[model samples]
Target: VEHKVLAGPFARAFPDAEFYATDRQYSFPLNLPDSFLGLPPWTRPLPESGAASDGSWGGEFDHEVLTVKPGPGSMYQDAAFFHGPSGTLLICDALFAATEEPPPILTEEPEYLRALLFHARDTPQEIVEDTPEARRRGWRRIVLLFNFFFPTSAAVADLGVGPLLNLRPYELGWGGWMPFRWKSREAEEEAFNKYSAGGSPTMLPIIQIILSRGGSGEDTLRWVEKVKRWSFKRIVPAHLDAPLAMGPEEFAETFAFIKKGRNEVRFCDQDVAFLRAAEEGPLSFSVYKSSLGVLRGQPCGP
Candidate 1:
């Protein structure tokens, strides 16, 4: 374990809080406390696949925390997965979310945190009286409730089978949830069809980054297949405002964009292939070079 940029603030904010890391390799400019290693609540490195049993986590966290290192290797070489108590399967940078919604804020921030709950789909409140005390109490209760239910402290997510991706602590205030600002509904729909099957264009870059690492087109498919086994009912990606709640039988449809991009890799321009090949090292010279290409603007060919 190593110290992150937020280590100081984190330590200052929660003096008693403990830290944890996955089995994957980690390093930083600063040294991390040894207590984080193999400690209680931290648990051991999670299994590479399958539903992690309750006892596996020592029951310290109340819910299962399954770890899924992307196939071939971890994403960004520093990614980790966890099955949150809310039934949400969390991913680090392996995936992202995007949509055409405005930043969910009420006026300037400070009020944003409290304002967000007023609009949240799952906000437990029904009648919020119009009063300073009522508003303050309501906001406090929501925050406390979310601390346990959604747990944004690590990464905010709802009680569903969804994932959120990398959001700098800074951008968290700027509404990191809405990653993409669509220029138009038509353009948005077009990109949606090509990138995320009208669900999340954020998956495009993730797939590209994966392919740049010599990722097999099947990575998303395989991961999705395994996720299906977990019987997750919803998807709350960190980037997108909309939670993906597809039918169990039609869940695979949500990832159609990734599958399409994977299949279309072979059709990518020669230059893009060469670039990816150069980045992926010499592992599969011809395979990766020829099979993994950019999806944003496909080249017709040389």
Candidate 2:
């Protein structure tokens, strides 16, 4: 932890300054076994998740670290930084608020527009009109598909962890998920409402998969509670919109599904079919014996 704090660009920028991550981040990085996100005043240490999650605070903001045991494809670790002075909350991939328009940074790259226009078309051979209406249509599709992985009636076109490239080759137009049908604009708009929880921020499908599979969501709920303790007037995620006008309560509401302890958080169930299949298949974990299964580290099975 000290290494991460002292070795990066920040360390280089201010060689005289000291640095530290949040409690769990400093104590349990790369997820020390059984560790989970926790609450903090940054003075007292809490013993949970098989270790002492120490506290640290300084500089101009408060930070909270969240480490989750979600399997592959999930945000294994992230932290939230709240700058009380500015009422701004800094967050990474754990949360997102999809924007109606593509972020200007992305649009600066012309290939991004082509990527959007390509998605706007249902078939590879279909033409993508360059009108504002066509751009809006394409942007919405990109956001939905990126968030849901595979929205109903829409096939995937490489939700790559890297940049979104213009994949059309030799004037053939679109390359991935060719011939797939896209849902009507009206239906896609409705789906956005469901995913965004009626125009507010919501967990990305990839991240929600973690809560849904977290065995009644107890671990994740605990984390959400810790985050809700923060007082942030706005949230700025690593991706998507910046400086979202959201109070802490509005942010917490997105995780209400975890409080229910089930997969009741519906965002077009059909759209998340792939996510469902994952929890039940490749990412599933369970008790192999008695109540001691967890104690014995036998909580996961084939």
Which prediction has the highest TM-score against the true structure?
2
Q: List the residue pairs that clash in candidate 1.
A: 162-235, 162-236, 163-237, 164-238
Q: Which ten residues in a row have the lowest lDDT in candidate 1?
A: 146-155
Full-model lDDT, candidate 2 = 0.57
- lDDT of candidate 1? 0.38
Positional deviation of 187 in candidate 1, in angstroms?
Answer: 8.9
Worst 10 contiguous positions by lDDT, candidate 2? 292-301
Quickly count the clashes in candidate 1.
4
- lDDT by residue (1-302, candidate 1, tens digit) is 33234444554565465444444533332223434432343334444543443354444222222232333324223232334454444444434444333234422465664454343322232334444443333333333222122212211334342213423343224333322222333322332333333334234343444443344435555655655554455555444343555333454554565555543432223213433443456533323332444333343311
Query: Against the true structure, what is each candidate's TM-score?
Result: 0.43, 0.65
Error of 2 at 40 (Å): 30
What is every candidate's alpha-carbon RMSD to the true fold?
A: 13.7, 9.7
